[model samples]
Target: MTTLVRELWESGYMHTQDIAYIRPDGYIKITDRLKDVIKSGGEWISSLEIETILSLHPSVADVSVIGVRDKQWGERPLALVVLKPNAQETSADDIKAIAEKAVERGIIP
Candidate 1:
């Protein structure tokens, strides 16, 4: 057996490397992965959640969020985005506006 298969067999469960939360409704919500979560000002930020919010924008084709060093917050999320092929008019401010809306809605803290 391969190393990965053997490890899984020994562990009895596959390590998906995902982090989740069981909500008050008793539903499981997959937040993000251990490696993908960003620690900012002692708070955990889900990169996947940010990506999901950014993807809702019409001009966003693809997006990835990563943590970057910040003096004040310890770390901050940096979004790398790919605009739609016809999205020549979309600016960085436009993408930022989407995230700002999410903050206003309390979807992101």
Candidate 2:
């Protein structure tokens, strides 16, 4: 284990629990692992992707996406959101609508 850790450390990947790819330009693009992915109806969804999309909403201050068991889809994404400061009028439906728009835009499955 020590040797493996040393090898990873020497490679400069650090303690990231994510998969990544190196681009031709030497840019490293990190992606979520299978364990962090949400599988629903044979579609692979990234929780971080959902969170990123939700964070774009003007009223959204913070957000997290998790997988919940679903009777039909097997698993569904549940968004936990916090509203921005002084944004008292935002409702759950409003947040849902923002996510729906992201789906339409192909940002998230």
Candidate 3:
């Protein structure tokens, strides 16, 4: 992980505006660096982490996770997703709720 992080920074391949990458191995790779990550409340809330988890849902066709300013935590990760076509039963909130449930189940949280 350290090596990957170093390469990511050194290669200059990631940006704040880029989208996240979801690997076939069920690992979410951060394709962008948004604001150097949020360091508040003794926790490093990585946008990539949130993106990866949100993207695990079957409905997400494309996803990008960004950190937004917050008064309490200084920053909070916002998951922006693009759904696949022909999605008839799923909504944005539904995907979020599913992801939240996954987290609660200790599968992603």
Write the residue-wise lDDT of candidate 1 on 1-106 in tens digits. 8654554345685444557878999998878766778899998988888999999999999987867667789878878799999999999999999999998998
Error of 1 at 25 (Å): 46
Off by over 4 Å in 2: 1-34
How close is every model to the real structure, measured as TM-score? 0.67, 0.65, 0.57
**Residues 10-106 of candidate 2: C-alpha lDDT, one tens digit per residue:** 5675543456789999999877553567889999998888888888889999876766667688877777788989889988888889889989999
List clash counts for every candidate, in order: 0, 0, 0
Candidate no. 2 TM-score: 0.65
Question: lDDT tens string, model 3, 9-100?
Answer: 55665434455788999887866453645565556766666677777788788777665556687655567678888667878788789667
Pick the winner on lDDT between candidates 2 and 3.
2
lDDT of each: 0.82, 0.77, 0.65
Q: What is the descending TM-score order?
A: 1, 2, 3
lDDT of 1: 0.82
Q: Where is the poorest 10-residue window by lDDT in model 1?
A: 2-11
Candidate 2 lDDT:
0.77
